[model samples]
Target: MTLTHNRKPDESKTAVLAVNVGKPQALPGQKREVMSGIVKHPVSGPVFLSFTGMTGDAQADLEHHGGPDKAVCVYDYSRYAALEELMNRKLDWGACGENLTVEGCREDEVRIGDVYELGEATVQVSQPRQPCFKLGARYDYKELPVYFQDSGHTGFYFRVLQEGEVAPSAVFRRISTDPASLTILDANRIMHQGKQDSMGMRTLLAIPTLSDSWKQTLLKRLTKLESEQQG
Candidate 1:
């Protein structure tokens, strides 16, 4: 079967519903008290957006979390209800530890490398957020890490190209569209599903705007697959 992608343009001029920030705090884990920034609170005023991330935000695990490429984690505002229903628990904005909680910017609509003018700052889609055990730890649901990975409801990240003060109600403008059109949904599917399709993997690898972590991970997998195929 041939792979075909159906993408929808995010035409709605939906302004960001909330801007959230969190500093590292003690969180309850299954076996230990973990330091994490996953539990964020929505901000009512403008927050400075820099290359590092929102001014007040900080991640406990720097190696795995914060960096220039994965500066701002963004989550879909519409996903909360479905997740609450599935998890049988209520969740709020910044539940995912994302800096920007937005509407209409679903994984299928936002493409890698796509540049957008968000408030006074300019940002670009770097990669899909790869949820890990930290997420499950945050909510006290151990399976959430796996569910987030498989469900593709995992949000994406943004690299701030230009720094400025961003407000809660700022709108997103697609200032530059990536010609690759590689949606974050597709990227998640390819990575999590581990499909044996070289073409699909290559498509993601071709994207210069892809986060370095993702590129390295995908490349390593592809290399292993190639080695096995040759042997």
Candidate 2:
């Protein structure tokens, strides 16, 4: 399926792949720390993979909850002109909520179900956005949810199909497609109250944490809907 957008694809985009390490003397699983690096796609796994506007503020809250050095966003790896503009600022940090600061590649080009190849790993786009409580405290802008809703860049999450170490300068590419009909954005929209009736059962089955009771209840409803769709 072709993903249509008003803008052309920018293949030179860059981003970061930051992991969480507790402390200076700790391993990866010990604690959470944000590191810097370059990446091709923003929504792949082993990275924070958060959206643009609210992510900076949300990172602060995550740090407060767990560690002070929480990794936020990976940088925007698509626009060179925008990247240069941001770099010209005298600020010591490269915006907040970004563990992996990226430049060059076309992030917006990615639709739901798109697979990004990050060296030894393959990341599959999962849900659209996970708006959590951490957001409210980060910006103190109680309406962050609305901000995400309005702005379309609600970043995508990725499931790790293959595990491997990623670095700042690592290269990434695209891989295969499963149920090419689904998209991360569309799935997320469906997950919301809008197009729930149109989502595929296979996609719904992938969400493991979606409570058994809720799943069963939804299953019953979906069973009826499936009959209707088939009819």
- Residue-wise C-alpha lDDT for candidate 2, range 95-200, written one tens digit per residue: 2233444433233455445566764555554444444533333334445545444443344445555656554455665565455445444544444544346455
Candidate 1 lDDT, 1-231, residue by residue in tens: 222112222437555877999999988645777888888999999999999899899999999999999899999876776667667776676878889888778888889998989999999999999887888887777898788788888999999999999998886777888655688889999998956877789989998889999989989989989999999
**How far does residue 37 in candidate 1 sit from its true spot (Å)?**
0.8
Candidate 2 Cα errors over 4 Å, as ranges: 1-108, 150-152, 193-231
lDDT of 2: 0.40
Clashes of 2: 34
CA displacement after TM-score superposition, residue 204 of candidate 2 (Å): 6.2
RMSD of 2: 11.2
Q: Against the hidden true structure, what lDDT does model 1 obtain?
A: 0.84
- At residue 133, candidate 2 shows an lDDT of 34
